[model samples]
Target: MKFDFHSHILPGIDDGAKDIEESVKLLDDMAADGVDLVVATPHFYCMNMRIDRYLRHRNAAYEKLRPYLKPEHPRIILGGEILFDHSLVGNDKLPYLTMQNTDFLLLEMPYAKLDDQIIRGVEAIVEDRQVKVIIAHIERYLAFTSYKSLCELMNLDVLGQINAESLAHFGTRRNCFKLIEDGYVHIMGTDMHRIERGYASLGKGMDIIRKKFGNDILEEFERNGKMVLKNYSYEQIVG
Candidate 1:
């Protein structure tokens, strides 16, 4: 299945789609991109809002678009793109932020250097919180993080999600491919925020993947994504 694993299509919860109408439009565009399923990962920051409040708002926003959902459009899944914070370590409620009932959490890192604190925090989230972390938009961090540092984070038994937008770019594509080649990246997403981009670029990125890597890589992505949607524990699939 073609899963647009990261997106901000939820209405008004974060700086994604603005309202129900906009959310529907984004979904429609996703359908055109041949996306089979979508994980509406609105931004979640520990410092900015309480998890409970964010959950409430996320549900409310999804509910607004639930009625308008059509068969042609990709099915929507609820998930959180949490901004990584050390306070989240050992938090019992971490699973609630995972891909709805799944053990995988999409965690976004800050734009600064990816270093010891960030790496250790990811370790704590996995070892302490007991949730698998999929680093959101792993390609974007190349601007700030050294390649060796990225390998350290990936070595912590966490997965990486590459944004389709990153692959569609000429400059970023090489590093994105390098991540895939090194086996750090395991999944893909549009990270679709606005209607103007991401959606179409998803198709473009996948096309690029197909041409350069072939169908087998796409199958790996689909298999991993399927396991995720079925609520398979990361250990069950990876370990």
Candidate 2:
């Protein structure tokens, strides 16, 4: 199935859709784009709020948009774009923060220097929390460190997610392709914040990959997406 691995479609919970109307529009557009499902990953900061309060706010936002979710629209899967923090290590709530019914946590690294300490913190979360960590929008951190550091981080069994919009420009597109060729990218996300900002780049980005790398390359991405949302078969997910 075509899965949008990351999104901020939840209403009023974070800096995403303002309310139910905007959320519906985002879902409908994603449906038109041939996206079968989308993970509604509003940002979750462990250091900023209590886990109970965050989940409560997140669930309530989902409920607000529930009535507008039609069968034709992309199905929503609850998840979070969690900021990595030392406090999250060994926290009992980490599992609850994973993608719904899956072990993958969409982890967003801090914008600071990408050092061994940060990498080790990520490693601890994996070894201790027992959840697969999907590094969110891996392309955004290019200025923070070198690809070698990222490859090293990848070696610890964490998957890397890239924003589909990263392929918008020539320089960025080459970097994206390099990541793909090097086998560093694990999944793609729209990172859709609002209609004004636009999220349609997902289809364009996939088309670029298909044109440059062929159908097999696109299929490889779909394959990884299937692996993440494996609880449901492709036949079972599509309406």
Candidate 3:
């Protein structure tokens, strides 16, 4: 099954699609692209959403989309692309917002650069508690430009998720290749906001993956993603 680990498909919750119709259009495109499952990761910015309010909105959106969802269609799972903040780590209620209530949390690091706090927060979530930390759109982390920090993050058992569009974008090719070569990237997400761009970007990335790594690697990515979606520990799979 092709499972997209990150997306902003929920309407009006964050910076994703504006309404349900747009959300459905994106889902339809995903289905056409052979995406079997998508984790509906609405943004959870630090300064914005409260835990209770976020859940309330997420649940309501899930219900609203249910009748339109077909079992045969690509499945939409619940999750959030949580912006990394110290407050989220200590919050007991935060884990419920993860995909299927899984221990795996899709975290978005700051866009500018890596900092001590980001490292500490990742350590708290993954190393200290042994939770699965899937770093969302890791290609955007400018710190990756420094090989040392990228290596440090890789050593922490954090899985890197690359955005499809980034791979297609100029200047990011080298970084994307390096991540794939270093085995840092574990999954690819469309991160689609607009309908026209979503599936096409994913296709472009998949094409690159296929030409460079072959079908076997793509299958492995899909398998790993399914394991994540099922809440299985990465250690179990790695072992």
> Pick by TM-score: which candidate is best?
1
Compared with the true structure, what per-residue lDDT tens digits does model 2 show for residues 1-239?
57789999999988999888899889888888888889999999887888889988999999889988889998899999999998888888888888989878899999977899899999999787467788898877876888888777766767778888888877778878887888778788898888778765678889888888898877877878887787433223221
Residues 75-149 of candidate 1: C-alpha lDDT, one tens digit per residue:
888999999888898888888899986888999988889989989988988887478888998988889989998
Mark the regions of model 1 whose C-alpha exceeds 4 Å error after superposition. 198-200
Clash tally, candidates in order: 0, 0, 0
For 1-239, candidate 3 gives per-residue lDDT tens digits of 67787888877777787888988888887877888888889888767768778888988987887777755667778888888888777667766767775788888877755666677777777755535788888777755446666567667877789988777866786788788888888888988876755464566788887887788877878877877877788786454
Alpha-carbon lDDT, every model = 0.86, 0.83, 0.77
Model 2: CA > 4 A from native: 231-239
Cα-based TM-score, every candidate: 0.95, 0.93, 0.91
What's the CA RMSD for each of the models?
1.4, 4.0, 2.0
Cα deviation of 68, candidate 3, in Å: 2.4
Candidate structures ordered by TM-score, highest first: 1, 2, 3
